[model samples]
Target: MTPKEYFKQAYRLDKRIDSQVVKLGELRALAGCAQTISYEEKIGSPNRNTEAPFVKVLEKVYLLENHINEQIDKFVDLKYQMADAIETLPNVDLGLVLDYRYLQGMTWEKIAEVMNADVRTIYRWHTKALQLVQMPENPIII
Candidate 1:
């Protein structure tokens, strides 16, 4: 993968994790709503079981949570690997730009504001940083 793409893995994973968490929340809501006291009883094996839906939703939420946790772990590891790679660059300014843009997930405007430089300069530095980036020998590809 290219340097830019390698660095973007963390960002993409983070977004994926966020979306999964939202889904988990929705699932939990559904599960909560499923908890209703039923006055009627099933005389025999009904067409479908009432508790099945809730159980399935709960199961999905559980699996999704596990998946999200695994993704989060991968993201953290990738960030550490990326940080080590960025530190290999000789230029501190370039490294800082990469850290702000990639590691901290800062936007161009925010990076520029924090760095006390113009947005154009931030862009320039980011370009240079990407150029200087040496992809890890065994990058954690998504």
Candidate 2:
């Protein structure tokens, strides 16, 4: 993979985790909404099923949360890998640019502000940084 593609893996994972969290929140809300589930069973004899009405939704929420946790773990590991790779750059300036853009996932404007440099200069540094990037032996695959 190209350097930019390799660096973006963490960002993609982060976004996926965020989306799962939002879905989990919505699922929790739906599970908690008792009014949404019917209390009345058949008008005839009582059903033999012992399972609670909302148990499925609650289980779904829990499963989603677990999935999100797993994704977060992946994201953390990927960040550490990326940071280590960035630190290996020959030039400190190039390393800083890679760290901000890839590890921290900062935008050009924010990186420029943090580094007290113009956006154009930051872009130049970023281009150079990508050129100097040595792809890790085992980059995290999306």
Top candidate by TM-score: 2
Error of 1 at 54 (Å): 1.7
For model 2, residues 48-129, the per-residue Cα lDDT tens digits are 5657867888899889988888888888888988888888888888899889887788898999999999999988988888
How well does model 1 score by local distance difference test? 0.89
- Itemize residue pairs with steric clashes in candidate 1: none
Per-prediction TM-score, please?
A: 0.87, 0.88
Write one digit per residue (lDDT tens) for candidate 1, span 1-142. Answer: 8999999888988998899899899999998884666689757766767565588888998898899889988998999999999999889989999998889999999989988999999999889889988888999999
Model 2 lDDT-worst window of ten: 41-50
Off-target runs (Cα >4 Å) in candidate 1 are: 35-52
Which portions of model 2 miss their true places by more than 4 Å?
35-48
Q: Report lDDT (Cα) of residue 115, candidate 2.
A: 92
